[model samples]
Target: MDVGQQPAAWHELAATFATIAAALFGLFFVAMALHLDAISTNVTVRARARVSLQSLALSVVQSLLILVPRQPPLWLGIELITTEIVYVMLGAGLRVRAGITALIAAMPIAAGISLIAGHGPGLLLQVPAIIIGVVLGCWQAWNTILPAELQTRRTVTKARR
Candidate 1:
């Protein structure tokens, strides 16, 4: 068991790889179930299905851009635009504030513009993007964790049971 050896030399560990893959698949399925449950009331299952489809399409385009040596410019454009559109739709569906959503929506476009500009994105823009993303993420986490009436209803519901 030489730890420094490459993955290619681990061909004999097919069973271990299979076990890991199975575990990862199970985790992914469980996550999908939780996600579906969380959004079921506000978003219809069919709408969720459409979102998944759109996401899959964008993922394919992104993969091509990353993996292909000669990825088409059109594919990159499609991937970038579709991703932003999907993010915006998801943010609206989840009732996030417009300002926060707008900032999040602009992130990729900002990065793309910077890349196209050839000099690359400055640290100034990157720093703000990171800070904005972290702040918005924390705000959303707090909102989800402490919903209005959650504390009041929880105590009453516990007493009833």
Candidate 2:
């Protein structure tokens, strides 16, 4: 079930697919780097993109371990951690502790999924993905509190003026 265990042709095909995904990821970062205007022009859009990218990066890691046979080596882990640090910086700029709890919660869930799937789920990884997806979705769904608090504080200060 794992990539190493697959037939030669299937392994080659999967490697090709992984290469394509990695290329696309690189292109996205390049575009993001080149177009500072997109973020500068719309703060809200930028904030959303940061959060989306954080979730996306986490999902990518999870997928690599569960769905794909390649359990990213140490370098990939380092790269992901670095990317997360950047995401955390952007998130903190938007809100003091934005995404912290969700990110923390995601780690164990992803690991649990991997453990359950036994490194190669063949197809059972889908179940764990659904479970983790629900958990993350719920966290986001309830993320309104922080924004609401900020808005309330702003309103209070405005009333005092």
Candidate 1 lDDT over residue span 98-118, tens digit each: 675566557545644443443
| Highest-scoring model, TM-score | 1
TM-score of each: 0.41, 0.36
- Counting only residues 3 or more apart in sequence or on different chains, how many pairs clash (N, Cα, C under 3 Å) in candidate 1? 0
Predicted candidate 2 versus true structure: per-residue lDDT over 1-161, tens digit per residue: 46322223234443443444444445545545555454445555455445434544544543443333443433333333454355445553243243554554444444344444446423232234324433442343234233434555776799999
Window of ten residues with lowest summed lDDT in model 1: 1-10
Poorest 10 consecutive residues by lDDT, candidate 2: 121-130
In terms of lDDT, model 1 sits at 0.41
Off by over 4 Å in 1: 1-82, 120-127, 148-161
